[model samples]
Target: MRNFIFILTKEIRSYFYSPVAFVVITIFSVLIGYYFYNIFAAFSTISFQAQTDPMVASQYGVLNVTEFVIRPFFGVVSIVMLIMLPMLTMRSFAEEKKTGTIELLLTYPVKDLELVLGKFAGCMGIFAIMLSLSVPCLLLVAFFGDPEWGVIVTGYGGLFLMGGAFISLGLFMSSLTENQIIAAVLSFASLMVLYMVGSSSGFVGEKMGQFLEYVSILSHFETFARGVLDTSDITYYLLFAVFFLFLSMHSLESKRWRA
Candidate 1:
């Protein structure tokens, strides 16, 4: 636990001192803000429905456009993170190996679990920082129109889970190569496949289509988008995040026997 804390703190400090994390945060803020602004424009002064009064719900158009627009709006945000997370996490182990510092770091009397958790936690911290920067835009939507606060909370939570899963996947891929570019490419390719897996399910016949849809990250995100906050979706993301983190830890353990 102490060793984990040491590495986690060190890596987080490196993120703060480095430009990668800052760049990711800046880009996410701008992009999400732009997306939220577009939603406001599309809805205009007219709320989703004709609100005779602020308290009454109208039976006309959308009950709330916030969930419909902002929740799925993160599809783009998720892909953007896929690109950006690899760039940050790629250097986690790859740069160390490139500089021959990995061996030295490994020599520290730390267990494999400690090292792996530290790296994952560090990356997740950076992700949290980047995601938090979008809070202002999330709040602003409420002013222009009646966006459900509960829906936004659950929706953003899904984004956080999505980012964590991406971070772990990137970390595992980064562990594979000394070249950051190769790591980035491998990670991005994996993410693209995951992103497309759900959409392609519709084209396939019924037999395989259900299975493919079940495998997609998008399938789980639907609950939050619709403001359901289903526990099944939450559980799936938690398990998925754990799977990639475990894979990353296993990869590091395997490297111990390298010649």
Candidate 2:
């Protein structure tokens, strides 16, 4: 635990030195926030469209504008982060192999699990930093209108879990090659599949199509965006994170042997 925490902090500090990471997070947050602000403004306006049969009525009632409209726009930020995480994690093992640091680090008393976990923690740590920077946007939503704090909190919770799932996948892909570009490609491909997982049912039978939707990460996220704290959705996110982290650890273990 002590070593893990130490590595976590070290990894996070190292991440702060990367200018690309900062730029990506800043650009993503600003874009997503700006989009949501416009969405809310447009939705809240009492236009002729609303004066007649309202296009989007009841901002404060069920299917609240804040949850259905504004929150989902913020969710786009996660997809942007997913694309960038691989570029960052790709350097995890690949950089070590290129610079011969992995060999030196292994020569020490560090256990394989510890090293694998340290690297994973490091990736998650960096991602956490990126995610934390988006909080002020949510704060803005709160200040602009009566945003339900609970729904917003749960929505952010879903985002955090989604981030963890992608980071774990990225870390695993990074372990596959010494070339960062390959790692990035691998991560992108894997995440693309995951992103499309819920919608892939078009090729399946009707019964199985429904099943796929239930099993999909995106499907579970809808309830959270709607302010419904369903235990099933929470469990799905937790399981998704756990499964990918385990896969990442296994990838590191295999690399240890070949190294």
Which candidate number maximizes TM-score? Answer: 1
C-alpha displacement of 245 in model 2, angstroms? 2.4
Off by over 4 Å in 1: 45-60
Candidate 2, pairs of clashing residues: none
Best candidate per lDDT, number? 1
- Candidate 2 residue lDDT tens string, 97-191: 77888777777776666776787778777677777877776676667566777777777887777777777777777777878889889988877
- Provide the clashing-pair count of each candidate structure: 0, 0
Q: What are the lDDT figures for the candidates, one per model?
A: 0.79, 0.72
Clashing pairs in 1: none
lDDT of 1 by residue, 1-259 (tens): 9999999999999987878778877887787778767766665545533565554344334555664567756666676677788877888888888999989988889888889889999999988888888777766766655777777778788888878888888888888889988998898889878878988887899978988887787667777766687887788788888898888788888977767
Q: Tally clashing residue pairs in candidate 1.
A: 0
- What's the distance in Å from true for residue 115, model 2? 2.2
